[model samples]
Target: MAANENKEYSHKFDECPTCDGDLQYQNEADAECLNCGEVFYHEIRANRHLLWDYDELGWMRGVVSRA
Candidate 1:
């Protein structure tokens, strides 16, 4: 088995589960479906590191401090 086989996998939904619309990034932890206007909020992490912080409207905000 590969070294990464036991690691958790993080994925982004290509289509919205609610409406099957194209998912677009609204912010760091939020996404919106273009067709149905459905919004999704989730924290995505990879390689045991935080990829982005959860924010409703943090497009301009800097990196979030975890301390």
Candidate 2:
């Protein structure tokens, strides 16, 4: 089997397709383009477990919570 055969395949758009701007993670299932203000949504699998939260100071905190 290929090295990536067991890994779950997910596509991430690192840059904006229209303007080539930097992309920021808006949430677990969405990302936004910094320069062009474009938001992109992705489908997250139910078995793929990941969670993120924000503190009072607006810093991102990543947690692995599976349900």
Candidate 3:
């Protein structure tokens, strides 16, 4: 994958706090408001860089199947 491309898909939500519009989740915990351009952090950690990078953490999710 390229520097910009990520193996895992980051979640996105639309919800604006200032304008009560839409907020998009930039990463696991950070969200940005589409209308007001506000940023919200759900889970605050001491080391932010370490938490967001999945490759650094070596997190792997198993596949799911529907019967």
Candidate of highest lDDT: 2
Ranking by TM-score: 2, 1, 3
Q: List the residue pairs that clash in candidate 2.
A: none
TM-score each candidate. Answer: 0.45, 0.46, 0.40
lDDT by residue for model 3 (1-67), tens: 4543342323333444346677677666566667766565543223222112122244422211111
Clashing pairs in 3: 13-23, 13-25, 14-22, 14-23, 15-22, 15-23, 16-22
Candidate 1 matches the true fold with a TM-score of: 0.45
Model 1 steric clash pairs: none
lDDT of 1 at 30: 63
Model 2 residue 9 CA deviation (Å) reads 7.5
lDDT for 53 (candidate 2)? 37
Compare candidates 1 and 2 on TM-score and give the better one.
2
Across 1-67, the per-residue lDDT of candidate 2 in tens digits comes to: 3555334324455666547788687654666779977555444356453333334565554432322
State the C-alpha lDDT per candidate: 0.50, 0.53, 0.42
Q: Is candidate 1 or candidate 3 better by lDDT?
A: 1
- The runs of at least 3 residues in candidate 3 whose Cα sits more than 4 Å from the true structure, single-residue gaps closed, are 1-14, 44-67
Q: Tell me which of candidates 1 and 3 scores higher on TM-score.
A: 1
